[model samples]
Target: MLSYSEQEILAANVNPATGLATDYLNLFNEAIMLFEMGLDMPDMAEELADWHPRGYIEHFEKSGFELKDVVIAAYEHAPADIRGEFDAACERALTMFDTSIRVLMTANLEDPAAHADLSDRLRDMKGLVVEMDSHIHGRSPAQKSLQSEVDALF
Candidate 1:
């Protein structure tokens, strides 16, 4: 059985050869912690309103996880529609992660085939990041233009 730290260290390494950046690892750690908390809270609906990573929180909540402070922070930071999207994505990603973890746990990496399967399973997580990036970057162009205008005004 993998210790929690071992699991975290393994999970944090998105790309070993390229070496995952600290920011990405931090984001992953934050995402995992918030995911677990979101799974245990009682007033999930209310809490979700303020989650910082609102998207991921909402996603997990929909996947049957409980909501906690992360939900509240999300609502505090995101607009209504974006919050909804975040929640949905969080739910989807959490579901995928849960299944992926189970699959990884069942595999015996001593077998080369099992190791390859584990690798494939991890690569699948990149989709979650991709989905998040799409949402996070979708508004960048407009935000940049607005930022430039504000900078000029100042």
Candidate 2:
């Protein structure tokens, strides 16, 4: 499980309702929040674990479901007014990834000592991402995909 401070840091990265992040780091951080929330709640975990168009649609069809179900249904079938919000968020996140790459490429690298320190910090970040992904999704395909993305980042 993530520590309280870690959870808070992740939560602070994005707008919960729209899942929007201001930067590339926050994009992954928001994903951490989603994975953690689903892991901490049984019903949510079940829904996430069985996540697929058919399964979610079936869940939506069922009547008298729990709050989690309703929330997931609403998200899947977002109101027409907000239907493009998620897509826009995704595009913004991808643009931020490019910005992050540019920052990394142009970072000051004059000091060898500082380079070593930065390397260590990036390694730590990679470890945390892997740990969080494992804790939430175990060895599922989603975990593998997430791990691959984190590996590419660091």
Top-scoring candidate (TM-score): 1
Instruction: Encode model 1's per-residue lDDT on 1-154: one tens digit a residue.
Output: 2222433433532222221212322344444434333333323323333333323334334433232233333334445565456446556766666565554445454677866665564455444555443344343223444444232221
Task: Determine which window of 10 residues in candidate 2 has minimal summed lDDT.
Answer: 47-56
lDDT of each: 0.41, 0.37
Give one digit per residue, the lDDT tens place, for model 2 in 1-154.
2222433433433223332222333334543343344333323433333222122234334524334333343344434334353344334444443343333344444556645554554444444444333322223224566445564233
Provide the lowest-lDDT 10-residue window in model 1. 13-22
List candidate 1 stretches off by more than 4 Å.
1-77, 137-154
lDDT of 2 at 62: 55
How much does candidate 1 score in TM-score? 0.41
